[model samples]
Target chain A: MANTNASAVKKDKKITWKEIKRQKTLLIISFITVVYGFIFCYWPLTGWIMAFQQYKPKNGLLHSKFVGLDKFKFLFGDDVFIKVIRNTFCMGVLNLVTSTIMAILFAILLNEIRHTLTKKVIQTVSYLPHFLSWIIVTGILHDALSSTGIINDLLLRTKIIDQAINFFAHPNFFWPIVAFANCWKETGWNAIIYLAAITAIDPCLYEAASIDGASRLQKIRYITLPGIKPTIMILLIMNIGNVLNAGFEIQYLLGNGLVQSVSQTIDIYVLKWGISQNDYSLGTAAGIFKSAVSIALILVCNWWAKKTGEERLF
Target chain B: MNTKHIKRSLEDRIISVLIAIFMIVFITVTLYPVINTLAISFNDGIDAVRGGIYLWPRKFTMKNYTTVLAMQNLVTGAKITVARTVIGTFTALFANALLAYVVSRKRFLFKAQLSFFWVITMYVNGGMIPIFMLYKNLHLTGSFWVYIVPGMIGAWNMLVLRTYMLGLPDSLEESAQLDGAGYLTIFWKIISPLCKPVYATVALFVAVGQWNSWFDAMLYNRMKTEYTTLQYELMKLLSSVMQQSGSADTAKNSTAAITPITIRSAATVVTMLPIICLYPFLQRYFVTGLTIGGVKE
Candidate 1:
């Protein structure tokens, strides 16, 4: 019995060694991937040191003189930074709320469509804008909102206004414009996930609602909405982590000096300080601040999701 | 009873009409602006300025496209953008697939820990400044590899691919192994073909991202004349035209006679056309791809 057990152990060891050797290619590929991650994603962390230093391009990060929290102090003391934080948060919240609601409504409406061909065509058209570059979308917005653009022409013909409104120039319209632009670009695309969620809801629930004499709205409120709550919660948690990212390109493109106050987010601030002004330390500090906030928001959202008995990101 | 049934049918008809109107208005709002820009790009210069072009060109001409294409650096920028997308997508998908395969294996030691590490990175990154400095330190500042290497590993894409991989039966791999086939063989021959939908979806995501990306090029690629990607090049062209037109320097630089509206529209159309053309082919995979990534078992 001892001899048989010993032979079996030897055989298992040999098989394991052969298996490792056989999987050498996969191991090598994975090593390359890990190395790539370390190099690009991990190595950049060294530059975080500049957050402490009054960094100059001439005096490289290694040789730069360190000043502790001066950049953060400057950022906090600046009224402009506070306004940017508010603008970023407000826009983020508006976008999150409106987009989610629009997406769900659109998905529900789409589900009610009886014609299969019409449903497919609308879905196709709606998602197309999501793929376009922000540069192009900004250009489209500029044209549509311009004095002689179609929107102004329509509004004029309808007598909605006595004159063409300079929508882009007004600070009051900045957040609304951003929110509307996001809705226009994303409502259809965002609806896809919700549509998928809705489709997965068992048809029996709808039948049960009908048998119980529930109207369409009641059925939607009780059955369809509840069925996709988990997906909504998961998506909400994931998007909360991105509350700080009010998009860099659209704001950068659309923003002029007139409405710069409302348009400048943390990202644009970092670009101005870090790249344009060449204050690497200040830029790094600002960036670190944004990341810290994002991490905290994500953790909070995850906790909320768990507490609510919904599917969490983790 | 008859009156109630008639009222219900009337309400249903009204609802259908409302829905149709809403969809029509939404589609027009979303699509017409883009299409109008395209029409504007093909219109005659004076007609384009008058802003009457809508639905179709007033005086049909390709003057704007030709002018924009003939600009000093447009062709080179186009080449750079195309090359970046192709190369970046290839490297990213390969790295993502390999990493995903390793993590998909339940028996792999440290699988859970590795997944957490990747997931954490997605929620919090070192931010752009640190990333720029890292690229500078590595001496990848002016190189094409700068675009490809830094963006190769996307944590979200990796996780999605890993989840898709996990959904596959392990028996396929075990049986292959029992037959003296290696993990590499199993992955290439058995698993890869099965994951075509996910692969295509991931490819579309990476390809579109790389194609549209101008931020990285703007940040690290300061060599304006030589290294500008297509989007950046178009941005510079428009901004310079805007500056020149807005300034007293127009007469001196009369070669760039393109108007703001025309140039802007042309740039928009050119940058967007390739991807728009590519989108329909990948539309089928998008719904499937999204559901796989989002829906938990």
Candidate 2:
């Protein structure tokens, strides 16, 4: 961003109408994007005012009763809201931890395979699930974990379980199932970044380590892991900001009456109240809380990254 | 040296065998669900409920696909999904690339300000309820344009395209300028052709997104059947089976031959078919897109 104009800094550069006229095409394009950015991106921000009001759809924003933070007061006071926050946090942490570890591990192990053709096939197959939407992924998950499904058959054949387990029916299983769903869908896709970072590592380090009689595990531990630490830290910090966005689609699609306690996320809560229950004000309040926390988290993480002399996002 | 070499080879061989086993297990786990679903879709719906169908369908039948394809709503959905994927992909690619070009130009004054303005949008959002309300207010609900307009100029896509364009030789643009080409002419005639790889990348991302999306359809166009999407239709079928246990009678009333499990599987298969067909093409472009090396002519 800072260096955009360095090339244009010539002595003959004129700050004149003729100069402006020369850039007419770009200016027009810029104006279109500016208008677009405001309309689609910035304009909805004004509607955040609904969070502070007893917003009625019929009355609209202007005529709606302004409640002065009453909706937030209700939200903070509600036990359901508190539970929803906890669910969002727990599932978020679970997803973050599992997805990160799996991606890095997959990348490292994939790096271990010396066979290029075989490695490419595995990597390509691994990314197959990433293209699938949560609807299909969760549908497949629902099928795979079903009582009459293959999982139950496998367990039954091994006599590991006397009977089938209703995996989705139990609250305890919901979080892990969500995490596994996230891992299945995303781990391979996320590994691409780590793989790129791993490839950028100096291969000579591996050669030198091997010459010193280092084992493969030792080489990976000493060389590959440290090589990708910066990438890990940068990605980890960026993800810290999105901690509230555990997921809506997967939970929404897979969740049922049985697991409702564990499955309701902030997004689902907002959708439930804002649209279904017609409690627009409460929904807006919850949305505000999410946005505020996200922005704050990003800022705090950015500050920490700066202090540690890491690659800061800003 | 020979003793050490022999010892390392023994260890390396053991590890290689272990890694091969692990890769085989990983591959099976990753591809099993998709293959199982495909098998179930081809299996007789009633026999699929008998519960032993593995890689191959025990009782093969095309009835499930036939039933799913026969639905009028699904046909509407498939059409809408195709329209959006094609329309959304082209428009978003052009719009985002154009915006990127506009904001990335060295000579373009206000480039920094415009870039920052869009970049900030990446981190902060107006939240869901407000955006829904805004859309409702703008009369975008129940309209097909809703899919295209709001998502036209993504900041991330714009940034990727901009970085790619910036990597191109400045001499090309300069030489074009000397030949009396305007910015628009250079953008269309010169820059866009050179942008095939990155364009392919963005196109795959946007196309897959538009194709696989169902939430927008559920949220905005649920009541508007004419504007339905294949994924949303599948979601409805999926949730039905989910609501009642997987073997529930959601489809039992229709035919004993087609159970909810096979119908849901078939519907899901239908919904994701386009993306799967295009997956090979997607794989080719996205890896290159994410790894930004300078393009050489």
Candidate 3:
């Protein structure tokens, strides 16, 4: 019996080799993907080495002299970098608050609308801006808010202001405008999750509330809000991880000389200093800092979510 | 009791009326910019700069559309956008589904390890500088291939597709294998057909991503006009016109009928209209994709 079992095992090994040979096509495809992955995803990770080096493009990675944390020190010491970090966090927080509130409010308002066709049309129209590229959205904003455009004209006719205000020109309005633009673009899209959550609430709960003489406002406050709380909390925790990502495109496009101080994000800073100006080492250092902080934030938020007994990404 | 009933009905009526009014205002806010853009594009360019054109064209003309279409660069951009959308979406979907299928097979010895390689990428990346440096070294910069090649496999999309492929009945593949079919045949013949719903979902995402992408143009393809996407071209036009003195051509070609703003508004409409027109029809699929990919872990 032992001898037969050993022979059977040997036969299985032979068949395994044949099976592997049959998988050659799949293996080759996987190899190609693996190479692609390494070049695009993993290889750039090695470029993080430039963060600690003087990093001349001509010198490349190996020959570049190591500079330790001097680039980081420089980034920290620069007033502009400090201000850019402030701008990033400020805009991030502003966007998070305004967009979140607006989305939840829109979702709740949408839930209240009893007419089905009206709800569908409203939802369909509102989602249109979210599909548009930031370039087009920025263009629309630029056209409408230009000194000679409709917004300024409306403001003037309504006696809100005597002069037409170029909305993008002022640093004071930059963060709020960014926040408002984000809200305008994303509120409808973001409301989708909340709406889904609302739908999942047992209809019997609403029926019970109505039987208890609950007002529509009371029904929303009690039944609807609680039903969607878990979804909101999970989304909020996830968003907290992205607090440094204020945005890059809209800021990059809308920002002009006057508003640059307030408009520059960590991403735009990296692009400008790292790629555009060719300060590879300094740019790499900034990139490393951003990645590190992002990872840490996500992990911390996950931990917090776990502690609070909410859904954790991990 | 009758007074209370009357009061309650009256309250509900007022609430409904308020909601209707609010929704009207909301719809107007959403629709106004798009209609205003359409109006400006058709309005006489020089008249548009004077700024009272609201819902309809003041001095109606199609010259802005004609001129925008006339630009050789705009034509090139349109071609690039279409080409990239088709090629990028096709390759990305193929590669992603292939990877997902391979990883979904429990019989595959390296499934967990292979899947880990992609899942880890969801959390960590080399950041933009390293990626830019790597692309520069790869000679992918200044080429159209940069857009399609790097994004051929999105880890997040792969994971979602894998989850979907996993949910497909194992008996279908098993029966095919029993009939002497290989993994590729089984995947292509059976799994791909069964996975159409998810495929469409991922395809929409990839297509939209490719269509909307402009940053890649700004980053890698900036040196060449041939690779400029419609979005990137629109961005350039918008910025140039918004800048003082605008660009030289607009200033030089200054006709009595056309202004840069009108041209820009027309271009903006051009960039957005295709997606907008298809949106209502496509939105059902998109909403399903979002919920499916977003929820259920």
Candidate 4:
């Protein structure tokens, strides 16, 4: 029995060595990938120290003296930073609500279409905007919302308004415009998920509802929506993590001094302080704050999802 | 039954018509701006300002294109953007695919730990300041590698690929192993080939992201005009032109005549043309890609 135990141990060690030798190529590939991650994704993390230091390019990160939590305190004290946070949150929430609702409605409507060709065409058209970069979308917005743009012409021709409203110049219209652009860009793409989820529902359920004399809306309410509720809940929980992103390119492109008050999101604030102003510490502080908030939100939402017995991201 | 059927039929008809109208209005609202921008791009500079054209060009000219083409930085920017997109996407895919494959294996000893490592990074980043400082310290600033290296493997993309990989039947890998196939051989000969759809989807996502990205350029290549990306150049050009034209009243006798609406529209069209043309072929994959990442079970 002692001899048998020794033999088993010997075989186990030999097998492990054989396995390791056999998977040498995969090990090498994984090693390279890990190294890449370290160099690019992980190494840049060292710069986070700039958040604590009053960073200067000439003095370098190592040579720069640390200011401790002064940058964070400065951020809290800044009125502009406070306003930027509010704007980011407001825009993010607006985008999340409007885009999700529109996508859900669009998906339901698209599914109800009896003709496959028409549905395909609508889906194709809707998803096209998702591919266009914010650069192009902002350009389209700029031209379309200009004083003599198509929107103004249409409104004027229809006698909806006597004069062209300066849509871009107005701060009140900034968040709405951002939301509208997001809806336009994402609704079609976003609807594809819900549509996929809806299709996963058994066709027999729809037939059963029909036999029971349920109207289309009633069937949708009772069956289709409930079928995709888990997907919706999961997506909602996941998106809560991005509630501070609000976007940077679109706002940066569209903003001017006139509408800066409302258009400056957290991302733009990061850019302004971190890149433009060369205040890396302040910028890092803001970024750290944003990251922290995002993590907290995700945790909170995940907890909520768990408590409700819905799917959680983690 | 007759009265109820009639009322129901009428309501259905009304609802359908309302839906059709709403769809048309939404489509038109969304499409018209894009189409109008294209029209203005083709329009003569002077005629575009007169503001009569809506659906079609008036006094057509390609002068705006010529002018943009002649601009010194445009070609350089385009080259940089294209190079970055191609190289960045390749490296990203390679890294992501390798990592994902290893992590996807249930029998792999370090799979769980590696996945946890990636997920934690996703939640808590080093933040921007630290990242910039790291780049500067590493002397990566002003190098084209700055754009490609810093964002090589997206954790989100890795998660999606891992999920898709998990869904594949384990029997395939098991059978291959039984046939004297090693991990790398199975990955190359079996797993990689079967992952065509996911690969194509991720490639498109990464390519488009790299193509559209200007933030890194804005941050790292600020002083390096030679390496400025296409989007950055476009932003710089448009903003400068707009600044010049917008304050024409303040800066009277400034190049107001040169700041034609057609030139701006033309630049916009030109910058967007490559993406728009490439989108239709890629749109099919985009939906699948987004759903795979977004809708976690």
Which candidate achieves the best DockQ against the true structure?
A: 2
Which candidate tops TM-score? 2
Q: Per-residue lDDT for A273 in model 3?
A: 91
Shift of residue A37 alpha carbon in model 4, Å = 2.3
Any residue pairs clashing in model 3, and if so which?
none
lDDT of 2 by residue, B147-232 (tens): 88899999888888988899898879989999999999999999999999899999988998998899999999989999999889
DockQ of each: 0.50, 0.58, 0.55, 0.47
lDDT of 3 by residue, B1-297 (tens): 664554565666787788788778777877898999999999987677667888999999999999999988888999999999999999999999999998888566556778888877777889889898788888999999999999999987997798888888877977997999988898899999988888988998898889999999989988898899998898888878888433345555676678877888888888888889887888777776677666654
Residue A311 accuracy (lDDT) in model 3: 72
Better of 2 and 4 by TM-score: 2
| Model 4 chain B poorest 10 in a row by lDDT | B250-259
In the range A15-108, model 4's lDDT, one tens digit per residue, is 3767677557666766777776677667767777788898887888789988999999999999999999998899899999999999998898
Residue B248 lDDT, candidate 1, scale 0-100:
36
lDDT (10s digit) by residue, model 3, range A1-314:
87996675456434367767866666677777788787778888998899999998888899999999999999999999999888888898889989999889889889899789989999998898898988888887877787767788889999999998878778898888788789888989998888888988999999998778888888988999998888888888888888886568889988989898999888999999988899988888887888888889899999998998897674
lDDT of 1 by residue, A1-314 (tens): 87996675456434365756655665576677667677767767777888999887888877888899888999999999998888888889898998998898889888878899999988888988899877767767777887677888889999999898878779999888888889988998888899888988999998988778777777878999998888888898889878888667878878888899999988999999887887878888989988889889988988998898887778
The runs of at least 3 residues in candidate 4 whose Cα sits more than 4 Å from the true structure, single-residue gaps closed, are: A1-19, A56-64, B1-8, B248-259
iRMSD (Å) of candidate 1? Answer: 3.2
Model 1 complex DockQ against the native? 0.50
Which is the better candidate, 3 or 4, if ranked by DockQ? Answer: 3
lDDT score of residue B47 within candidate 3: 74
TM-score comparison, 3 vs 4, better candidate: 3
Weakest ten-residue segment in model 2 chain A by summed lDDT: A5-14
Off by over 4 Å in 3: A1-29, B1-10, B245-255
What does candidate 4 score on TM? 0.91
